[model samples]
Target chain A: MKHIKTLNTRSLQESMKKGGCGECQTSCQ
Target chain B: MVHQYRNNGYNIVLDVDSGSVHVVDDLVYDVIAFLKDDLSKADDAVTARFAGRYSPEEVSEALEEIRALEKNHQLFSRDIYRDAVLDFRNHPTVVKALCLHVAHDCNLACRYCFAQEGEYHGVRALMSYETGKAALDYLVSHSGNRRNLEVDFFGGEPLMNFEVVRKLTAYGRELEKMHDKHFRFTLTTNGVLLDENIMDFCNREMDNVVLSLDGRKEIHDKMRPSRNGKGSYDLIVPKFQKFAKQRKELGKQYYVRGTFTHYNLDFARDVLHFADLGFDQISIEPVVAPADAPYAIRPEDLGTIKEQYDLLAQEMIRREKEGRGFTFFHFMIDLTGGPCVYKRLSGCGSGTEYLAVTPWGDLYPCHQFVGNEEFLLGNVTEGVKRSDLVSIFKSCNVYARKECRDCFARYYCSGGCAANSWNFHQRIDSVYEIGCELERKRVESALMIKAALAD
Candidate 1:
């Protein structure tokens, strides 16, 4: 919360949901 | 056109073109919004708006602050692309990650599989070594001035074609030395065919391994049973646990992911279940299927999902207080260092930046479109012959979508997934409402959790 500056809504969704693509991180399942 | 949102005594503004965000306090918030509403409005009118509470001198001082923000280009919306990246569209494309469908054949039959049970609606076959090599070459050559290149050995199960996977990792490494590019590999598996040999090889060669273990045993077995109709949890748990331990020791990247549907509306329990199992990195999401699909999270169930997210947040906080906190992938969004406003506005570079190559050397936008030839860009052999489709997605920024400009969370979500749009609305620019609602709920929950933690 220390001045949360970034706001990537789609990445937030991908981080939560596993659309079966893993490249987002190294990235997904 | 700068837009504003007031939350928790902080003002958050979005400059659509520049993708700049500024967090200011009450007085400054008013000053920014006042000028944004009508920059030409006389200072006397602004004094009347904040009348009695603030004197004219204070309004005049606030005007000074407004000018400062305007000077910084944070108060007004204007195209900053030329200054930021300098003709990004015309810039060479960089293939950072290539999802290679090593085996078109899958061993399990997940009821909700968008890949047509892993065969991708095609004949069951594995990628010939020739195709796999060509795809890797395609990834390397097309990757413009990028040092970090990634390959996801995806399939019905990547383990199905372990030999090619083994061969490709070595081949990719060889290419890395020749091309001076670093190749990072990932293996996404259902974990049915995992063995000591495969695990050992993966631990040594792979950068990250995405093991699919739906949170709860019962729910997973029900949704993702093997061809012989038996629970995979029993077979996968020990191996997955072993890998998790190794990942922790090596500081490697890995996540145990699951999907929650209409059936598991109380999905927070699944998050707890994973934590209890001693897994630290966890991500759970709703299934991306159509509304009419039997297991879709319908409108009525949204409230329940929201409640579950809230409950999960509380549990995470409680565990942290008790010194057992874990990283829930969604809950750890640090906006300060996230992607720039433009990237967030357009979402991931799926079709344009990332390409999924089938075992037969065919290329689709991403893995989701592998079987759907309508999205087929071309084969790896042909090299993206469809510039028309490529331009369509390349031009798909959130501003281009009419509905996104008015959305407060639009800066974060962009315009949702293109594949999802195509599946749900038959077009790339259309939004997927279910995914959008779920995203909004998750973003809300994340902000609430961040606020609580800050407190």
Candidate 2:
């Protein structure tokens, strides 16, 4: 619900800059 | 029971009752067509059995079976999809070269160096010998015999810690011997400490060397002076000339990079000074403001940099056409022509195909965040497996960031550097900071103008 709520008002651009729901933060290397 | 019928090109009927639903859509028509088309009698019987019966429970069971079949189909189809995508990937491998910061400590302290953070001098935390070995090992092991390997050595001043560089170079040579792989090596330096030994090393082993020269004597000296408050240009120019002479004699490639801060923006005449230095390849980079730095660009100053860039690009193009070549350190043309891949704007390759190891044996997404604790991927002591790295890569899709999806320059910029994106905007796929955006726009516009003029 919180993520959905955030998605509702936040521009897709803003959400993307947040690195896509914290997915980019994970250490892949 | 209620019967609902829907048709597009074919007719289908759904009948719902107390515990069963029937779908009798096109069964008779299908049987008639099959029979008319000379279908085998056995096949016709099979079709006819299902044709008249469309009970909800029966249909539900059939649908469940179909769903299970579809799942299996998809599981197998992924291989086919990957194969199709592989064709695109195979056309030309994206150049994902890195200028590894084999050494971080610099000989001189520039006033505007980003590595300086309130007593947290980043230069001192140089990559150790062990760290360099680990990084090289990682690169050699994971590269999977990738045909083209271009490596650049970066630093506060890479020469400040030349011993580690020597070790890495030796390791690289050993790896090459084992794998029979060839690599290109280049060094970017401030040029103050370059001497015969360095020149000899570069001539024999390296492909290209780039020197950081801000511009004319006054500007260069003012911006990049010695820590003892003395001008560096005068001290370094003679050494640069010697290096140039050696490069000419040795037939080695060399480039000069000029970084422009706000202080130098007002002066365009200083650019011509680089031309006088007998250096042909000149690169101009705008002063990049850190995450905490103020975000304001003077319109006039930006215009000045643009004007100089246009003039330089035009001159370089003209000279190149005349068979008298001059190099400008802009990668847009190389990127567009598919000769080089810029990691920053190209895509998120770090932690996916590329990874950086810190001096302390900690893995990172890339070298840009070498000392930053937040960026630590894993420790060497833990001995992370290859499969673990692969899963980590799959999970972190920087391109999926909503901001990146929506940005107009997403294709070109690739959400800028992922590390910068995470640190500054707190998102990996976010648009670059305002200053970066402006600088990129200026460079992009200049490149477009150059391309058009050449055309």
Top model number, lDDT: 1
lDDT of 1: 0.75
List, in order, the clash count of every candidate structure.
10, 14
- On DockQ, the leading prediction is 1
Residue B246 of model 2, lDDT score: 79
Which docking category, incorrect, acceptable, medium or high, applies to candidate 2?
incorrect
Residue B195, model 1: Cα distance from true site in angstroms: 2.2
Worst 10 residues of 1 chain B by lDDT: B79-88
Best-performing candidate as measured by TM-score? 1
| Model 1: per-residue Cα lDDT over B1-455, one tens digit each | 66666543445555544445555556766766777767888878888988887778877777776666566554575543432322345455666788999988888888888887789988888998899999989888887777788888999888889999999999998999999988889888988898889988988888888889887899899888888888788888788888888888988878888888888888899889988998988888889887888888798887888778778887887788789988887765565455544455546677877889988899888898888878889888779999788888777767557777566567567677788888888988888787777776666566655645554
- What value does the lDDT take at residue B115 in candidate 2? 57
Residue-wise lDDT of candidate 2 within B1-455, one digit each (tens)? 22223222222211111111112234433332343333344543544456556544444444444234224331011112222222322333222344466555666767666555211234355668787777666555555546445566776677877788777888788878887766667787888778788888888888888887788887787778777878889877788877776787777888777777777764345555766677766666666566344332354566566566656655555666777655554534332222111222235566555555544556665666666665556654453445454344333332445654433343335445666566567655554555454545444543343333433
Q: Which whole-number lDDT from 0 to 100 does residue B373 have in model 1? A: 76
State the weakest 10-residue window (summed lDDT) of model 2 chain B.
Answer: B13-22
DockQ for every prediction shown: 0.08, 0.03
